[model samples]
Target: MRNPSLAPPINRGLILRDFPKAEDTPTVQDTNENDTNWVALMVRVRDQRDKTAFAALFTHFAPRIKGFLINSGADAPLAEECAQDVMTTLWHKAAQFDPARASVATWIFTIARNRRIDMLRRQRRPEPDDLTWGPAPEPDQADVLALQQETASLSVAMAALPAPQRDLIEKAYFKDLSQSEIAKITGLPLGTIKSRLRLALDRLRHAMK
Candidate 1:
């Protein structure tokens, strides 16, 4: 039940059943926990120029953020650079920290993810816009979870639909074809394709709700 963020070796130990760092990690914070509040530390750093507290938090969180990147397949140097960028952001945006919205670690990781992705995109620098369709940016954690939820919802919705409707919806979205395209491919009338797609989407919407 511990926060996975605190255990840098969890990814390394995924093949095993146990992780030692996890032993010292807490499962959850108390509602009123006040000691070493990261949000408050940022506020003090911003308003009172409290470098001491800021340094402590930065030192603790930076390596953890770097681990997240390295474990996700980035090289050590890139991860460290991204980690530094994340901390620089913390310094500049200290006044913007909101404890209620996310934990300090989550905020740090989100910054790291964005900065790392930006670095990667710049490094790859996809072909000129005219030469290629732009590559999609990798989704952050929130987007990934939202996509997974959408997949799950779609699965359930598809299951709830009568088989024929699910098939139509699949052909429409997953196959990325127009109704007329699907009609031509499936040898059905365009009107029938449109009707099936509409009815299928309606059922999916209701089922998802």
Candidate 2:
């Protein structure tokens, strides 16, 4: 259940009265004093259960989170719901936030991305009644051979990638990590992560073709 006090307001101006616009707020890449301030707010929320601190955090982040989700292909209503859920989780998991490993924006946005993925998975999941409770049919030999060939080709392509690019690709696709998360783990700039991933994927595509 979500806390009523933390619920998103009907009017944006009502909640954002004193805070900066979403665009004006510091981003995950911004390593400024504001990041320290946000970390302090998180500490307040965690230790004091201070609604004022939580409200400040919410005002700064909620809209940005919603916009991120919408940009990622969620509709307005779904983005709103996911933003609310993310804020609520922030309140509950405030103690788990580690300032050393990630910025406040990074941690919060990672939660939003993960929540969006979970929602997508749930939407695509088949209902229990939709399952066919019977033995599966035998595979067509031609289809099996093609699948095996494709698998081998992919393995070869992956192995051929430069070590740096290949590591990022594996962390991204196989580990299901967001680019920001990958940047954190590898201690690389976000742009570097994206660039290497693009080059690696291009090479893999060319190889498979």
Candidate 3:
């Protein structure tokens, strides 16, 4: 049977208080010694289910995770909930941690980032009952014509763009890719992605006007 003590702490307030303020949180860029220690702690949690190691990790990372979520636009309550979820996931998925690919802080922060994204997506999703099942309304002819004209103008503007800028814009809006994802796919630096997308958007805006 699983030991009850191995379960994550339920007292969140106490956990939050254990760490220093978010601004003081150590990042992935911290000293190599600290990073190496975190890796060892994670390995202990994975191989032995060591509660002491888990507690130490929790004490160090919980506040940092919470702060990261808040900075990513999650409110306090949501950030706290997501931080707890990230820690719980860490306990369960310790075996999945690949030290060769990423440091402990990077893995933990990635989980927190994904958790916040999932929560935001759930909040923005429309309830099934709120969806319109049948839509039979006919479009107004004038509105349809206006839309067609606007679409044609947009197409022309898009075609006029330099290939690189247009490609980035298409990936960003049409493919719904994050800047980081776009950078990886295009083999471009992240700053280049942002710069091209910004320039592309500015031209498109001016063209549409």
Candidate 4:
């Protein structure tokens, strides 16, 4: 849990993009340059001991990691705690990331996902796949199975999404990441991330349809 006073100030001026924003056309980038960059960055951190580069990655992804958890339904404190864990793990395990196995967004999202699961350790039951962390509602077995199926379908759909489309969504929805966060992570202009996100959402809508 995060100290009430120590939370990084979330920018109120910031507005999160809607998911499946276009929902009419889901298009993947031919390749994710961000992933390519992360691969190189990971290698640099692991092999050369570049604190600057590693720190850059941490600064860029931390907020996105926080946003992703909040968007996934964690409260403010839990989200902040989760983000710290993600960054700490990244610092320790830079060598573990391989672009060949996953895109940057995919890999980070997986980490956040796993971290969220770990948080459930102290809870009596792991939160349902639906990820609602409020009061425990007794869901029937059929409802539970349906929720699992939905998560599985979304998970598969998430993997199949094109890099460009998925990138925006991952930063936005999965990471509850913002345009600014996306900009920082990929070193793209804010306008570029926003406009591109609109297009990507459209493509995702189409593909997921």
- What is the TM-score of candidate 4? 0.44
lDDT of 4 by residue, 1-209 (tens): 98966998654232223123223323322223343466567657766778888787788788989987887778989999889998878778665544333345556777788887667544333543521232122323343233223333334445554566557755564555767666544432234334433543354346445
Q: Give candidate 4 regions above 4 Å deviation.
A: 1-31, 121-209
Better of 1 and 2 by TM-score: 2
Which stretch of 10 consecutive residues in model 3 shows the poorest summed lDDT?
130-139
Q: Each candidate's TM vs. the true structure?
A: 0.43, 0.47, 0.47, 0.44
Positional deviation of 197 in candidate 1, in angstroms? 35
lDDT of 1 by residue, 11-73 (tens): 221111122122233421221132226656765776677889789888778888888777556
lDDT of 2 by residue, 1-209 (tens): 99988998553211212233223433422334456678678868877899999999999999989988886678999999999999999999876654433457767976886787787666433324511222113323343333233323333344444566666655563346776766544432233224433543454346446
lDDT of each: 0.52, 0.59, 0.59, 0.55
Model 3 scores a C-alpha lDDT of 0.59
TM-score, prediction 1: 0.43
| Worst-scoring 10-residue span by lDDT in model 2 | 130-139
